[model samples]
Target: MTEVGILGTGAQVPDRVVSNDEAGAAAGVDDAWVVRKTAIRERRWAAPEQATSDLAAAAGSAALRSAGITPDQLSVIVVATSTPDRPQPPTAAYVQQLLGAVGAAAFDVNAVCSGEVFALAAAEGILTRRGGHALVIGADVYSRILNPADRRTVVLFGDGAGAMVLGPGRGARVRNLALHTFGELAGLIEVPAGGSRRPADQAALDAGLQYFTMDGRAVRSFVEDRLPLLTKQFLHDSGVGPDDIRHFVPHQANGVMLDALFAELALNRAVMHRTLTHYGNTGAASIPITLAEAARSGAFRPGDLILLAGFGGGMAVGFALVEW
Candidate 1:
């Protein structure tokens, strides 16, 4: 079997900076309260003209450049996002057009924040059979779906995109991958309206169901209970131990929760990468964005073991091991 690996990575965040005071103003909170809860001081919000596809394309282009690959040479373009540019036509289609990846097949994956790792697993399978490079992008425009008054969701999110180029080339060689979903807990985080089950009608709009919502308490509990167990199992199954991981790139969820979880995992040798302090939880884009930033900074040493984890809506969790 041909080995699949990450060839390059890139990330793009909007220029608009929203401080804690700004994000919490409408929700009756202050910087102190927000920081105590999420450890996020500021985040980037998209400009009025920017959408998910635009960011995705920019990150994709950067990833391609880093990989020394051209757009036309791509065999697949996978965009992992919850906030698409539109309901119709996948966001990856727009990204494909923007990058002039005319030869690539494009699509979108909506595992919420877990979409990036899911997309990576999907693209890896495709490339193993097709023999060409794949551009996997994780992008979201959470500013569009957030309800200003709902601090639970609004204060914890930002808009951004991250991308990785994967192919049969030198980079971070993928060693193992795992994904799990607990559908029974789907209601823990979601948009009540906009889907077929609950159309965005006047009634829905009147009730403010179009905005994102979450049971923060329940989500925290879910991660606390499941993440450590799953992560251990994943590492064990891959013939590795927690101490063997050199770097851990987890979903940029809540900084507080991450801190607790990291301690519980006790990956003594791993450096946990985090970007939520400045970028907030950018849904699917969090992991890739953090990964790209770390890679660009020359953080990984050759033969280092990197573990990527993502968990979010659909009550999904994804893990992948890479040998750099």
Candidate 2:
């Protein structure tokens, strides 16, 4: 089978930090209450003028720099974003132009938090059959859609971007993609704008459902009930056992969720990567951000086994097995 390896990774975030106290002051919640429950102390928010595309461009440039590749050399640009800069031009086009990848097949994806993995699969598929370099970026300035007055969500989300450079098969890099989705729960969490189902309207704005909301308790139930089964199947399909994984980077939605996943898989403590402490939950950008930081800091060994798992809106879930 042809292989596609991640050549580099990069990330970006705005200057603002919405701490629990700040969110509490804005949305009426106790700082301690926020910490005890979600385990998040602070989250970043984009400036009023900053758009999601700005983040994508920044991270994409960083990835190109790290990969030692230039914009003109890129064959494709895939940007994964549920929160787009505008309704018309796909965010990828801006990134492509910014990176000087003028003639590439640029586009955007809408897999919510599972976007990074989704874009990864798309890039892997494209590179496997065709021959060219592709850049995958997941950047979200979620606060634009956020109701600044809502506490549950305003405290949980942050703005950031992450990028990865993908190309022809490299030695034991990304082995395969184990991606899955459950559309029935699509409404569990979503934005009702810039799409067919619920086009942007005064109605959605009035209802205050245009931003983000979640059945946290319900999603937790789903994770506890389904994640184990999914992980097992993912492992079976990839022909890799739990014990073989050297590191686990599950979604950064919450610390407790990650703790549950790591303990369930019996993964070692040393290799687990967690950046939520400093970056908070960066939606689709979390994985690449952590991975890039690790790469830059020399955190991985030649024989390490890395697992990437993410869960998000639409009840979407995905995992990838890689040898680093």
Candidate 3:
């Protein structure tokens, strides 16, 4: 079997900063109330002209530069996002054009917040089979899909993108990658219209069904009930102990959820890297964005063990174990 590992990582957030005070005011709440609930102080939102592919291209370019490779060298480009520029063209295709990655196979995957992990797994498999470089990006522009007046959803999302360049290497080998989805819980977080199941008609638009909606409490309960079981089984099957993990990178869902997971798993807070307080939740971009931030800050070192886990809207969950 071919060994695939990450060659480089990069992240990019928009320049527009939306502070908690501003968001809270827009949602008819106080800043303190928002902070107390989500622990998010601020987040970035893309400019009017910027789209998800724009962010993905920027991050992917940075990752290519960091990896000391050019776009033309890429064999594949996989983008994970729910927010595409248009419904017709895959976001990755736009990213590929923006990056000038000629001849690279490009596509998009939508697993909501768990998207990055899913993309990583896909890229790893591609490299193993084709023995070439793959650029994987996780990006989201939730600001466009969110209902500004809905504090429950609006306060928890931001726009950003993160990317990784992977190839056959030995820097940080991907040990285990697993993904699962529960469609029954899919309605817990979703856009009620604009899809095949519910086409975007004028009635849907008038009803505000195009906006994102989530059952915060139900989602929390789902995570609380499922995370422990999944983590336990993943660790057991991978023969990795909680103590062996030097870094724990999870989807930046929220601070409260992280706290609950930490307590339930009995993991050290020092080993967990969090970016939510500053970035809120960037949906699919969260994991790679957090990982890149941590990596740049020297939070990871050679020979350290890292565990990446994420759960999201499809009621999907994904895990990846690596030895750095």
- Clash pairs (backbone) in predicted model 3: 303-324
lDDT of 2 by residue, 1-324 (tens): 356878777888889877878866768887787777777888888888888888899999999888877888788899988888887799998887777787789999878888899998998898878867889998888777777687767777778998989876553388868778898887778776647887768887788757777777778877888888898888888897877888787778887677776677665543678877666778888887777787778877886788888889888998888787
Candidate 2 error regions (>4 Å):
169-172
The window of 10 residues in a row where model 2 has the poorest summed lDDT is 261-270
Q: Which candidate achieves the best lDDT against the true structure?
A: 1
lDDT of 3 by residue, 168-244 (tens): 76467788998999999999999999989999999999999999999999999989999989988898899977778
- The lDDT for every candidate, in the order shown, is 0.96, 0.81, 0.90
Q: Give the TM-score of candidate 1.
A: 0.99
Which one wins on TM-score? 1
Q: What's the best-to-worst order under lDDT?
A: 1, 3, 2
Per-residue error (Å), model 3, residue 35: 0.9
Error of 3 at 36 (Å): 0.5
